[model samples]
Target: MSKLTKYLKITKGVRVLDLACGRGRHSIYLSTLGYKVTGADLSENSIAYAKKFENKNLTFMVHDMTQPTGKDFDTILNLFTSFGYFEKEEDNLNTLKSIKKDLKPGGRAVIDFMNVHFVSKGLVREEVKVVDKIEFHIKRWIKNGFLYKNIRFKIEDENYDFTETVKMITLEHFQKYATKSGLEIIDTFGNYNLDRFYEKCSERLIVIFK
Candidate 1:
């Protein structure tokens, strides 16, 4: 929140859109700070959960991130690596275009993504974790310009498997998307603390643009 206050330069009553907000954590926080915030997500369950915290200044809705949520928001936030789930590159680019369309003329946006180079260099191969009495076997790998994670877990007599995939998008790739979407890259940080971004060492690719 401190990083947002600094980078976005937002003030009280500023309109904010939390795009792809899973459960409205950020929206709730910003609303408490006096911002008018709307948290939108694709999942109905997530929206329902988030709605429990809604007040006059905060709300949640089910909306697709690849489409325009609303018009003329002062700030738009796409955090926690939520921008790269689409399978096609065009879909990913469209998401940026949607954000550009929804923002006010001078509106700002923050995209919190993973640093591709850092993740590739320090990729974890395999690991096992036990959570709530369930053992999860996890494996990670990079292939064909995408990062992949396979998770397998069991509960009692049932088996479950899931795969998470994200495109290995670098700063250069995002620059192209921003240009095409009529947005400019203004600043970038390595992590939540707003440290200067180092391509090879940074853990996050947090871009601030307008």
Candidate 2:
């Protein structure tokens, strides 16, 4: 888990709701810190994998965050650039509204998103990595506020390739939508450590709201 997430979980008796929690990484960390955590994602496969780490304070469920939810929570987390995965802008805004509805009064939220401007300015057209005997290569860039990332994995016997594109909106866009959803932006961090925004620098925009 990221240190920023650990900082957020320091509140006492917090009930944390993690949206689109693939594999329950942050949820598990929050749970270990004594915060009640519920992780929701659409992938049953990911949920099944996360179940391997089940504990008394942590739970996982299948949920499409673009829709409505009934559970009330004290703090909601949308981490790791998961907010822009939905193609429809209205769906994303409505999801924020739904999150506000599910939050307890005086509750807060943490939304971590990619810094689109920085990425667009300093886009990495190609990158590569190696894991064990497998070589993983990626080609990523931004065009018209949409981020395109293509991956090619080469193993000893086989190769696999896939591409994922997300609408890369800026931090101002989220502030607008979150304000319409009744959540006020309390603070913005350039990355996990809370720095100022700059062109061609920083990868994440961490927004705290209430």
Each prediction's TM-score against the native? 0.98, 0.89
Mark the 10 consecutive residues where model 1 has the least summed lDDT. Answer: 1-10
Best by TM-score: 1
Error (Å) of candidate 1 at residue 64 is 0.8
User: In candidate 2, how many Å is residue 76 off?
Assistant: 0.6
Q: What is the C-alpha lDDT profile of model 2 across 23-110, one tens digit per residue?
A: 9988898898788899999999999999888788898999989775789998899988888777777987988898888889988888
Which candidate leads the pack in lDDT?
A: 1
- Per-residue C-alpha lDDT of model 1 across residues 115-159, encoded as one tens digit per residue: 999999998899999998788999999999999999999887999
Clashing pairs for model 1 are none
In model 2, state the lDDT of residue 113: 85
Report the C-alpha displacement of residue 200, candidate 1, in angstroms: 0.7
